[model samples]
Target: MKKTMKTTTPITKTLAAAGLAGILMISASGLPSAHVHAETKAAASTNRVTAPTVAPQLVTSKTLQSKEKWLETNIKIPVFQGLTDTKYQDQLNDIIESHASKDMDKWEKEAAEAAANAQKNGYTMHPYQLTINYELTSDGKDDSLISLKVITEGIGMNNGDPRVDTYNFTNEVEAQRVTLEDLFGKDYKSIVDKAVKTAIAADQDQYFANEDGFQSIDAEQSFYVADGKAYIVFQKYSIAPGSTGTPEFAIKLPGKGSDKKPAAAVVKSGAYYKDKNGKIMVQVSVLRQLQFNVKWNGKSKTTEISKGAVWSAVKLNKDAYTLGKMAPRSLGSAPVMKKGHIYVPLAFLTDVLNLNADHSKHGQITVTAAK
Candidate 1:
C-alpha cells in the first residue's frame, strides 16, 4: 500500500520567508552564494504553489495587430494637384506613424501628460484641420479671380468616442498669380475665421428648444449696412393642432432704421392644407404675399397673409388675418403652441424671410405688428 499526503504553501509562509531573506540580505553582506541559490529556489517553489503567474503579452500583441490593420485600411490621404508624389507619400507615412502607430501607448501617455501640463499652465487646446483647392482663370492683367472648391474632413476626439465630420464648400479668391502665398496668405486666418464663424452661426440658428414655455432665447443677427438688409430671430411656442387662431411672428431686425425693412413685394405660390386624413392636399395658384395693410382704426399692419400663408396658418391650426407678397419659403411643422402666442419655425424665418435664426444659446422670437 502507498501512502499520499496533500501539500500546500500558504501566503503567510511565503511572505515570512521573503521577509527573512530580505532581512538577511540587509544585515549580512557576506551571505554565501549556495545559501542565496537555495533561498531563491524555495521562494519560486512557494510562489508556484500559492499563485500562478499570468502573462498578458499575447493579448496585448493581438490587440495591437488588429488596431494596426484597422488604421492601415481605413486611413486615407488626399492627393492635391501641386503636391509631389514623394512628398505626399512621406506625409502619408508620417501621418500614419504619428496618429495610429502600433506602439502608441507611450506616445499617448506623453500626449496626455502634455495636455495636463498645458491645462495646468492655463492653456486650452483647439485642434482643427482643413483642406481646400481651386482653379484660377485670368487674361494676364490685374489680380486673377480664383474659383475655389473646398473639401473638409475633421475629427473631434473628446474623452473616448471620436466625432468625424465632413463638408464641401465653393467660393472665389482674388490673387495675382498661382503661388503658395496666394493659397495661404496673411488674410488666411481672417478668411478661415470668417468661414468657420459663419458655419457655427448658421448651426446655432438651426437649434430647437428642448424645454417648453417662454424661456429667454438668444441668437446671432447679421446686417448689410450698404444693401439696407437686416436679419433677426426669436424663439416662441408653436401653435397647437386643430386650434383656430392667428399665428404671430416676432422678428427682430438689425436696426430701427426705416430703410432696413424688407422691400414691399407681392409674390404668389401654391398652398397646401391638411385633410381629415392628416395628409397635405395641394391648392394651386393660391397667391400668397406680404404687404402693409391699414386697419379700420388707421393702424399700419405688415401682414404675411396669402393662400400659402393661409395654408401655413391652417396647417398650424391658426387663422390667417394678414396679406403679403409671395416669397420662397421652407416651412417646418409647427411645434405645439403654448399660451396664446404661436412660435414660428426658425428655418422658415431664416431661409424664407431672410432673417438670422439662432436657438443655440436661448429661446427668442420677434413679432411684427402694425405700428
Candidate 2:
C-alpha cells in the first residue's frame, strides 16, 4: 500500500507577523537536491518537524567621551550564520565583509565628520546616536531575505535629523547578490522604471513635482522584499515631499501589459496570510517550476534535484540545502510539497540548476533542460 505524510507548523505565522509589521510600516520602515523516499503520514505523523526559527546574532558597539563632553555613538549590527553549503558560506561571508562591517564603519565615520564640523564652526557638538535595525522580510531553507534600516541622528550635536537607507540582498543563483536582470530578465531596468512611474501617477500628490524627477529607478536604487512583494524605497526627497520621508511603493505590473515579460526567475514571493486562528502566516514559494525525482525509503521520503556535478536534497517541511552533495547545507527556510508541485526556495535553482537549466518555455516555468 502507498503511504502518505504531511507536515505543518505555526512558524509560518511567525514569519507573517514579522513581515506584515514591516509591510504596514512602508510609510516609515521596512536550494539543493538530493533524493530519497518518504514516510507516509500513518508511519511518520509522530516525527513531524518545523524549520528553525532564524535568530541572527547581533553585535553592538557604543562609545562615550564624557557625560558632558560631546561625540557619543551607538551601533547595532546583525551577523548571519553560514548555511551548510560552501558556495553558500562564501556568500554569507561576503555579505558580512562587504555590508555588515562596511555599514558599521560608515556610522563611525559620521561621528567623526560631525565632530569635525562642529569644532570648525565654533559650536559644541552634542551627543550623536545611530541605531541600525534589521528586519527579516523572507526566510527559507534554500532562500532567505533580510533588510537593514540605518538611522543616524545627531541630536544635541546637531539639528538631529536622522539619515536613513535600506539594502536588500537575496542569495539567488549562487553568484553573490540577486541582480535586477536575474530577477526580471534582460530588460528589467526599463520595465521597472515604467512600473514605478505608473504607481507614482496613481498617487500623483505623494510624489515630487515634474514627472522627470520620478522618471526612473537605477540598478542601485533602494528596495526590499517583504511578504512576497518588492518595495521600492526612495530617499527623503527622491520622489516625494520631504514630509513624506522615505516614501516606498510596492512594485507591481501595470494592468497586466508590457510588464508582461516575466522576471528571469520567480522567487519566493513575500505574501502574508492569516491562519484559522487569525494569526498572521507567511507563505513563501521557491522554484515551484523546478523538477525533482522523489523516492520513498523504509523510514522517510527523499527528493533529489541536480545540475551538472552538484546534487541537492529537496525535502519539504525542513531546511534543505543548495549543494547537498558539495557539502552539508540548509536553506534556513521551509519548503512544502502540496498536491504534485514542489514549492521551494530559488536557491535550489541558481545554486543547483542555473547554467544547466534549459527553461525553454518563454512565458511559463521551465523544468530540466539538461543534466
Candidate 3:
C-alpha cells in the first residue's frame, strides 16, 4: 500500500491544532525566557483490563516563534509481560520521535480534526484510546500490536448518506516468535499431511458422489485432492451469444439449515488455498458453475462448494501441479488435465457458487451447507 499525506484535514480544536504548546518562549530580543510552565500529569487505574482515562497536561508553554522542525515527546510507556518500563518507553518514544520529524504538525492536525469530528457526531474521542498493545515473546523481546477502535454516533440519514462515513484502521500484526524446543518428538509436518489427506477424502465424497448420484462423467476428471482441501473442476463445452464456451451456471447444494434444501453457494475468485510452503494450490477455471457438496464419510451433508474452496486438498498430492503456476490461465485457453487430475481456475468455481475465496493465510474457509 502506498503511503501519502491525507488530502483532507482531520477536525480539531483551535490552538491545539497549531504547534504552539511545545514551542520555546523568547523575549523581544530573541532571548530565551525563564518563565515557562511545562504542565505534566501521572495517574493510574486499578483496572488493567479496562481502558484507563488520562487527563492531558501541558508539556511546555512559551511565546517562542514556531519553527518547521517537529517537536517529539514520549507521552506514555506501558511495561507489561516481563518488559522494563523504561526500555519499552524508550523504544516507543524513539519511534514516535522518528516519525514525528517527518510531518509532526500534519499528524497533530489530523489527530485534532479526527477528535473534533468524532465529538460533533456524538461519539467520545480520547487520545488514550489510541493505546497500542505489545506482546513479549519467548525470546525476551517485545513487538508492538496496532489495535484501535473508532466509535461514531448514529445518524438518521437515508440509505445513501456520506456524512455517516467513518473509517476505522486497525493493524493486528502477527508476532514472529517461533520456538524449536517443542519440536522434539512431534511430527508437526506429518500431522499437517494427515489433516490434508482427511480433508481431501471428505471433499471427494461430498462433491463427486452424493446421494443424488455421481454427476461427473469421468471420475478421474471430476474431483481430486491436494494439500488438505478438495478441488472439483468441470467444464461445459458450449457457449451463448455474448458468453464464452463456459456459460454461466449456479450451484444449488443442500444447506446446513434445517430446511433440507440447496442454498446459494458463495465462492471467491483468484487464489483461494495454499500449501504449507505458501505456494498457490488452487487455480482459476473457465466453467460457469462447479458444485462441491459437503459429505461426511460417504453421505451428502447438505453443504455445497466450488473447486477453489478445496485447495488444501489438492496440495497434499506431491504430483499435483500448483494451480496457476503450471495450469492453463483461462478457460478455452488450454487443457488443464494432466495425467489423471483436472486443473481448473479457482475463480470460475467460486463465481458460480457466489462465494469469496479464502485468501487468508491462517484463517479457515467456511463453506455453508445447502439448506
Using TM-score as the measure, the top candidate is 2
Per-residue C-alpha lDDT of model 1 across residues 112-177, encoded as one tens digit per residue = 565666679998744322211111111111111111111112222222211111111111111111
lDDT tens digits, residues 146-167, model 3?
1111111112212111111001
Judge candidate 2 against the unseen true structure and give its global Cα lDDT, from 0 to 1.
0.40
lDDT (CA) per prediction: 0.22, 0.40, 0.23
Instruction: Please list the residue runs of candidate 3 whose C-alpha ends up more than 4 Å from where it truly belongs after superposition.
Output: 1-110, 116-128, 137-371
In TM-score terms, candidate 3 sits at 0.16
What overall lDDT, based on C-alpha atoms, would model 3 receive against the true structure?
0.23
How big is the positional error of residue 182 in model 3, measured in Å on the Cα after superposition? 8.9
Off by over 4 Å in 2: 1-69, 85-125, 142-175, 252-371
Sequence-dependent TM-score of model 2 = 0.47
RMSD (Cα, Å) for all candidates, in order, is 31.8, 18.1, 25.9
Writing each residue's lDDT as its tens digit, candidate 2 over 1-371 gives 11122222212122211111122221223200011001111111111112234544211222222121233434333333433234644444344334334434454555667778988999876555544333334443333334433343344433344444444443322212433453455566776677666655655665676853687776556555444345555655555665555555545322112234342333222333333434322212233222122222212444554433546665556664556446546644555544333445544454455523232344333333344
